[model samples]
Target: MPAQALATLNPETEEQDRRASVINELEEDESVDEVEHSTQRGAPNTGTTPANAAAQPDIGILPSGQTQPSAPDTPVAANVDLNDVVTAPESELLAMQLDTLPMPRPAQPLALLGSEVLPGTSARLAWSPGIQIPGLSQPTPVLAVNGIHAGPTLCLTGAVHGDELNGIEIVRRTIYDLNAEELSGRVIGVPIVNLPGFQQGSRYLPDRRDLNRHFPGSPDGSLADRIAHSLFENVIRHCDMLVDIHTGSLKRTNLPQLRADMNNPDVATFTQGFDRMAVVHSSGSPGMLRSAAVAAGIVAVTLEAGESHRIQEHQIEAGVNSLTSLMEKQGMTSRMFVWGDPEPVYYDSDWIRAQHGGILFSEVDLGAHVSEGEILGYVADPITNAQYPIRANSNGRVIGMAVDQVVMAGFAAYHIGTEAEIPAE
Candidate 1:
């Protein structure tokens, strides 16, 4: 999608304010992650805020919670930093920010994808939409871990865009690091939903359709729709909650944050479970998986991490920590995850675009707080050596930004999460 085509450029607005497009952060093209971004600001909110199974042997776990031959593997990065990225809030504050929702008590076994995942066991199942893809028709890998006790079924979906590697890593780390014996309900993970896209390193399906935009799809529709329908029916329906993970797209990067619909009470409560994670209110696009899931009476949110294509260890670690904290809050796991400082909930956001095409140089980093009219970066024309500064239109933090690279005029240069407000103490 062209950068110029994204912003709803207002002709009446003056030049100073017109430099930044005041779009509802959630409105985005199919090429980018559907969840929009903004600058970050405001006080921390404590209260606010903001699945499934299958089975097989050899690729399955015993009741003793031992790993099988096909257990999900961790990312193969030797120097990856596994430390907690965000600092913990004060002890008193942590105590006040308790789990707002009661723990679910699901005692029955998890039945999914034509197989039963018994309690205290894990399994790697094969899932397919039954669509023929020539040499790439193999069923996608699905990881399921059913806990011994009772709780909610949490589903984690990654690589919805295929090229977003950070989400895949986050899912893998969260699922495989689980101890079924110590868990309450269940965890279902699909690290790669768009298998063809992942294989080809493309963001779209073989039909060039954005798979993320087709959700709760129809079997009679296009290929993307069929696959979406299959996954939604066979996997998503089984989820008590869904975390559709993603990363920045179109040569952009995002701060690790939760894009949720704060209007939904259940979703708002769910957003509070993550520790030290920024929460951005994005009602979501019509066909988006997150919006579709919520419409189907399931609490869902999109976890936007780092950029696509490359796997950044810090982003992966931050995502994993947030998930662990969420599970711990939900009573699904006994892991002693530390709760971090409360991040503000952003109700609005804006995109600061470049006014001139040139080599972009960022003056601020991701998550940097900025006042309105502050210089975010500059675009320097190589031909005439003219430099144009990009300034913020709102007081907020830099939640997303394009990396230092050549960019065309009107490109989204900085996304600020504005109008930050916290839940009452």
Candidate 2:
């Protein structure tokens, strides 16, 4: 199918088809092993393990032409008592036989804005803070999937800017694809954080406010503030880590990359967990969710993938795989996930903007490597057919670019990530 045609298809339909195709492919691959162990929902008893475990599939070769690391040896049954395992700290529990240990009893109902979600189940709650028009009194949807086992909570938020649709789909698949019965930690997902803006296909709220710029908001402030406050205080504050998914705004599209404050030890650990995606070290702007979460001592990072207003399948798959890797790194799951390659880390990036208004045509695609003074694209006058070449200013990788379309003078056309740096914590 043509790329344009695929973009025009119903997003929900496309996602369903993608999911089915992935399942079919997995089923056909004899090398892939099925996870046979199952745990009882809402049971305080330790989960049961498969009598005979299956061998994990080989993860193939790394980008450097080396074989990927082999999976860890299957865990042997431990002699420790189930009661001790249940009461032990999470770090110690991870080293023991997890499946053979009993889960800790859920303490209390997880309270939210206007609802309470119990453990061992999922819920779609609503958050309405009394700000509603007559016909559009719809409340913001808050989805939660609490696992039967006791572990850290990971919050996945998407569509902070309403028009960014890739994250919404990423969150949907991440929550839906997870098996709550076998899950260890709790996952809270807010797929569409800016509902009003999403309804109008706008990045900003109706009141002309950028929802993302007003994080850790005030209860008695503007509409954006109230919404931000409700989410930060009621939902985000309870999380141990936050992954705010996003896409390029306006006319730009990004390569699958992660941005976080690499200076912070906790944030660095979380950022490194996305083994297959590129990482850009950045101390996020103040009032941004990542910045606020870090200030509140919650490990946080931002994922930027694809373009806005469309669901790209490859980007979605990348996002899903990154999240899965994160789950494994945090010991939230026992599943063995091996990444294909270690993505390069870039310390700084620069945007190449247009010098004159014209029709823009990109000569290179996202992730293309370019040297200083190389032509990345061209801008041409629609009537006179006069053209001007846009060149890279530094040796770097094309991390982001605008779609082929009419552009104005000084508009951001290409983004280059330069100065590749050693991975740091």
- How do the residues 1-425 of candidate 2 rate in per-residue lDDT, one tens digit apiece? 33444353336575556556545655665642342332322324344532211111323334465665554663556787766535457667776767778766543456766677676778988766556775868988888877767678999999999999999999999898777666677889999989888999999988999988899989999998988888898889989989999999887899999998878877776777886899888899988988889899899999999999999999999999999889888877767787777787888899999998999999999999999999999999989989999999999999989999999999999999985765552
Which one is best on lDDT? 1
User: What's the lDDT for all of these models?
Assistant: 0.85, 0.82
lDDT of 1 by residue, 181-278 (tens): 77898899999999999999998999999998999899999999999999999999999999999999988999999999987888989999998899
- Model 1: lDDT of residue 107: 62
Q: Any idea what lDDT model 1 has?
A: 0.85
Scored against the true structure, residue 30 in model 2 reaches a CA lDDT of: 62
What value of lDDT does candidate 2 attain over all alpha carbons? 0.82
TM-score of 1: 0.74
Model 1's C-alpha root-mean-square deviation from the true structure amounts to: 30.9
